[model samples]
Target: MRYPANHVLGAQRNGVNHVSMNMGTVPPGGPVRGTNYPVYPDKLLDWYDSAGAGPMGMTSVRVMFTWEAVQAAANGPVPAPGANYANYWTDLVGVVTRCLARGMVVVLAPWQYNPASKNTDITYQGQPIQPAMFADFWAKLATAVNAATGNDQRVAFDLINEPHTDEESSLPGDIGISLDGWFTCAQAAITAIRSAGNANTVLVPGMTWTSAKAFTTNGSAAKWAALTDPLRNLGVTVHCYSGIDSPGSASPTVLPDACSALVQWARAAGAKVHVGEIAIDAGDNGFPPFGGTLALAQAQWANWQQFCLANDDVVIGWNWWGNSAAGWWNAGDSKHPQGHHWGLSLDDGATRTVYADLIAGSVRTPRLVLHDNLADPGTGENTTTSVAWESPDIWVRQWADGGVVAEPVQGGRSCTVYVRVTNRGTATWPATGTDVVTLHWAKASAGLSWPQPWGGADPALGGRIAADVPIPAPVAPGASTVLAIPWASPPNPLHYPDQDGHFCLLAAVTKAGQPWYDGFTGTNLNTNILRMSHVASRNIHVVPPGQNRFGSLVVENPHREPWRVALAFEPLDPWQQPLPSVQGRLVLRPPEHVLHRLRGMDNLTEAGPGRVALVEPGRGLQGLVLEPGERLAVPLEWEGEAAPALRAVAYDTETGPGTPTGGQTFVLGEVEGWTVEERAALV
Candidate 1:
């Protein structure tokens, strides 16, 4: 099985993105100091070896550099020993030599357009200029590198990283260039390289951040078609980011649409396409800053890899965006409170996440189709060869009295609706993480309108419930197992008509901790719902967890009655241990006639001795009256070594503690860091 001439799949070889990289005082910094954030070239190579990239069929490395780094002045003599560009040349050439030694194709990508950098300057010789000057700069550097390394055949050059139309006029210090100007400049650069006795491959890219959306709609086909490569060694590159279409919506479907179209356009233009930079925000990176689930991110990248493999002739390869700054992890900005995550391997260096694992899996298991469910087994159906966001086709089996049966019993009576699921796709159904069969309840609708996961639900019923029975250990390809939940219809009288009885029961395999809507296709959602025939009012209604500066908890109202209820909080450490006391420590001072205080903050009244007033309805005098569908909030202050769990309950002297409802058992603490203060700092 021979592949395309240069159709080798791989990743950005740089250990970290230059823009986010820690400079550590570059001019006077140590050789590899900045890259010490976690990795450098050697470390990255080690990761490749350990991750089995060679066996997985990956054969290239896209080395990134900046134009200014190589040729500070557009007309500066070829990169030499004592020039300002010396260290950059040395580092880049060392990477190329090392990659070539490993028999990997090297792609030299010099970025002339960078809006993220603090210094966004592109000049020629002594004056700021545009595309033509960029061509001159590349020509000089390409000539120098080729001469220095003997014009190695494995070497290729990516003209620029993610150029856009607006970039021409965005900068005031430089002359602007149109899209056609970029093509013309690229043509001149190629000619210069070939003219200087170098025939390395040249990679050209479309505008608009080199995006796929731009490739298809931004008159890219015409520009790409007009590009002239005398040596006939040319390729086009585009970036596919989920956020391109919507914020954090990178799914298995987005990339292929753009990739397929780009490949078609490239084939027409007598060139191949390479995904220059691809990234998606998996949920772990934090929602405010980045959206989407880790599973979706994995699926998107894997599908893109699969697409390249399926179309090896037209779509050459792709590179996971360069590793990001280590410091950014958990140092979330205004958008994401948990910090940022943009690296192949985490900052810790010890753990390579599912992203890396998926890349390796795609290489080793190229074109290994995995479907959630297939209509016909012998027919060998192939559904577009994309990643499975949600398994669509699940066979739901219902049984009665231990014998196999079809239809669930009707009428308002308690009956068993035993169910099990089978894996019909090419991919394995993971037993853990976000992949598991969960039971959810939704009001049944007329006709075939199944309930969407994000649709409305009664506040009485909490979030989707996990199966009472554990998912069978590793539901491999073509495997099936019973659900952990033993489905017993809620008990009711005959022909019950309330909302509870007029509902459908759903069993979905969702990415744990993420919304069910994350799946690419509806296949993961089995709409063959078990219709309910009974109705029963919830004795207690518990809402999802809410948080404050002190702690987090779930509130519940017992019986939905209009009676006022008094709530009490008894805080204990994670292990249910009492707060340790050091000779009645004075960590805080209470205002006169008040109970609790944290320095300049408002003072709080206590419920009693040793018990803080987390929630008081009327100056610690009256109870809160909660009506149906209404809830009350209790503010708590967590000042301890570990997160505390509170025994919280709405109380009524007539009903007693047993009758009152309890909040969520555990409350996570804000463990930012340790605090130590003087015992008597206040007068």
Candidate 2:
């Protein structure tokens, strides 16, 4: 949903119940779809509501508050509705009222903890909160909330957020606390709320950050099951990040079964369950430093949401951990720090993430995704040879080669282009044979545009349509299948004998009614390849060592106006760096120079061993000016020596500054052989 720009909790700078300008009628529904809102209130109500069209389509909210904000002193009176802001009472009431008016089911939760106290008790101000004080606080809160909203059944009380022992430690379940200790305080709060004549649902969490898996593993299930509620309207709350109880980087292989344990426990305990907090990083499945793909994050959310929907008998709802600001600031703590990535929207709260559609459950159609780099799915321009093959999903096989290979497009020879597609959605793709996979080829270039660079109905663009293959079998959700298209003759590399003879293959999957592309307009190949899942491009080629290879990169200005463009080559380790066994250097020359020449030229500068930049004589490392639609062929000559493999990415940056506008990664090496077993092992 939407959040304020700053981290303010509620209205009123001091102690006064002020009138909230924003108010509306509450909406009604079931099976809560909600997100966590910041502590305070602000004018950004539409941030989440969006005038009834929720950004996240959220029906409820889990509001956060601190124990200190609720109770100023131990065993002291909890301020009433009109009470001053000494305890944030007025602000709390105002927030709850506003949320209800906007038709959002508000779940009030206390973020109370004092790890330094070194005890299992809920602490306030670094001291243990007495049971009597805890009960008194809940009793007062219940009365205030009841009176404030006429006992709105839509309101809920989440006992506490992620309760655990060893308050000072960041790890959840580090040193286990006695379940009985936590239960005593929880039961007291429940009793207090019920005794206050408030029937709003109460949610109790187990020890160890309320992780679903830990709920039963940590012996919390049995104790929590014993908790008694007079209203019999209680539920269990749990938190999950990357399929675990603790917040950290997401595991690509880890199937999200966060609710499995809780489902079993809930069935046995006969208690409803609510996932209070859940989030996956948008970047590389929400983990940093270790490269990953958006597909990983998409899978996590899809599977989790599916599980929750499937087990609606007990699991009632879930809340995304939070906004971008909180997520980024916490990164320093090394918890779930990539809040921007985890947030539904990017930092701006306007641009939706790739996983937003999945989170919103707005679309249930099949989403077929073809990975550019299997090792790192979302990375479009990949040169990593650490995994034998970068674009494992796409390969070429010819009887002459005797096996499957990723490079060396044998010109004028009959070959089979195999592309693997995975259905990442919840629906199955029917076997109508209409789900077509078309492969388009374009001249090897640092930047290539759609339709024009690659051919369509127009034969003037080199007529580069390689093959179109359709699937004959139904592709079930989460399942993958390979489509093989027989190419009578691939473009003869002999036609351009002076060029490297490498072509960039673009594969797009289309169904009868499904969108032709997933967020890809095809103008920016470099960026779109990484963002779009339904389309993938492969531009890798292997060259023999000690031989000079010439490749022509067609750099064009896609925009209408003239612009200055720069070309830069970045050295990359086909085998991720620091490998002593694999070593090599890449050498480059201008098109005007002879193939055997080793001398540097005036137009080129050695930025590093294998890295070089095209420069103008008077202007140091300058770009060339290109008019609209001007296609410039920049011939590149390069050779590799003394290494298993050498790779570099040639970037065609339009603006000359900041990030490159587009680029392509080229690799030089022997083709990595593929086997029948490897083909069968494709996921």
Candidate 3:
């Protein structure tokens, strides 16, 4: 049963307008995901006081405490609430309470997964754990933390955000557990808090969403609905996904369908929703060719956010995911993050005016504009492009329980439909982004929303390519820009080079100051192509006999990116009967002077993904994450002596094991310094 469509939540839900993200870590360094303190407690509060609570506006804040830290030295007993854990929280809880004084809500997120089970896990020292214990343990932690943060309405528990679909989960732990599991788990803590007479509304997920839509479509919706009850005014949170939308591939929408089902279900059930996660990867990537010029997919995401604002009245609250530098989650303004320039605006005070406009009122936003890259348009070359914009004022982003602010006002010309142009861009500067908007584009809607394939369901959701689509010129910041887009033939796009049956053009936006919303859409999408650069390079050489009864060989990738390097060595001379050097540790050094020893079959512990790393590169080194435009050097040497006719094989992670971009195998064929023999036949 769904909650009443117009059910009203009290002041706790409506009055306070603040969002939070689990940033940084415990010791607070690596990833800002779980509990990284993005800034020192004092520094954080200071910034909140000064900067106005990040790009989403509102001055409220929240963070999680490491239960592991509290329970660290537990030996004789699990310790009492007034002991080690209690002391630290006494101070921690005070900080959150202060946010309330400043007109903010202190949302407490306690102990996410202990990472006990799973192929990839967050561990306790070196041991793995069983998941069943997660429930009871969390219950105890909540009990303790509730006391610290005040259960009498000062704080609310986010309650184990996205237990599934995080990086720690198998593929993406973004799916829903049954209502029973949800209830049982939540019941343990809810019952405890209520017993203590605490009124903090607990948070949970509906059917559970993927880091986008990776889960909703995973076939668990019916199962999810099978387990609902009446009195749980519980908040079901979710993370949606618009696959590949991060890269600006327009189409493949996942928003509408998921939101409709969630809203309708909530309306029927009488519960409230809180979107603890939502974001658009704000970057200048491609968009579908509607009129003359294509735009960035990020723009499309912004427009959808406008729709979200319109529906803010329905859900209780929302939280943009994150960004940060010293940490990695919430976009921060420090100087550490490498893979982190994902923030909506540069952390150096260069506010992204477009994105910053979202930081206001702390209410769900409405659509002020609409732009759809229209990724992977209908399988034909003919598509009509139209744009709609609302200059007056609009807003949206990560509505609660997968909902969207879908009310599109006919702002008229403000809603310009760029049907044909070879160019398009931002005003006052080439704001390299696109704002593609579509309501039920997800083959879903509250009335009759979309599922995975919206294009296959609704005709209005798609269009024919407009003639003379524009191609944007190189961007120059702070300058009014205009570019055209031309819609050429064979509409839509496929990820691979040339494949039949086109996918829809789709796009999503990850609010800069946040993490990519666990988002999704209901349609397949096609992305545009950038100028494909085809130039490439490689290097190979044979090493002659060397000291210590061995020889050496080296190979290199002179061009950018770690390339697919190949190496091969068969006996070049028929007279050399190369006896296989049983000791595979024989090594050869490359320009980097790293020695590469032949692997004795026993040395490799083969597993799924790839062979175990015997020479795993350190975190900040160019070991595994090979960079572009750089050469890699490795050395080779053997343990035993051999004839001058043994052949060697060379290959790398890039071009595969046999073929590099050079067209010619980097080291294919026989070597002149040793007897070339089959690896399988070696003694």
Report the error of model 1 at residue 319, Å.
0.2
TM-score of each: 0.46, 0.44, 0.40
lDDT of candidates 1 onward, in order: 0.45, 0.53, 0.33
Report the C-alpha lDDT of model 2 over 264-284, residue by residue, as the tens digit: 667565566777776565454
Residue by residue across 265-382, what tens digits does model 3's lDDT show? Answer: 5545544555555543333321112211123334444444433433332355545444232233334222333322233333322343233343333332211111221221211111
Better of 2 and 3 by TM-score: 2
Cα displacement (Å) at residue 668, model 2: 87
Can you write out model 1's per-residue Cα lDDT over 408-527, one digit (the tens) per residue? Answer: 234334445333454433345443312444555433221112233224354233234334233564656555554434445543323322212223344544323433332122221222
Order of candidates by TM-score, top first? 1, 2, 3
How high a TM-score does candidate 1 get? Answer: 0.46
* Candidate 3 lDDT score relative to the true structure: 0.33
What's the lDDT of the predicted structure labeled candidate 1?
Answer: 0.45
Distance from true location, Cα of 245 in model 3, Å: 5.3
Q: Rank the candidates by lDDT, best first.
A: 2, 1, 3
- Model 2 residue 614 lDDT? 42
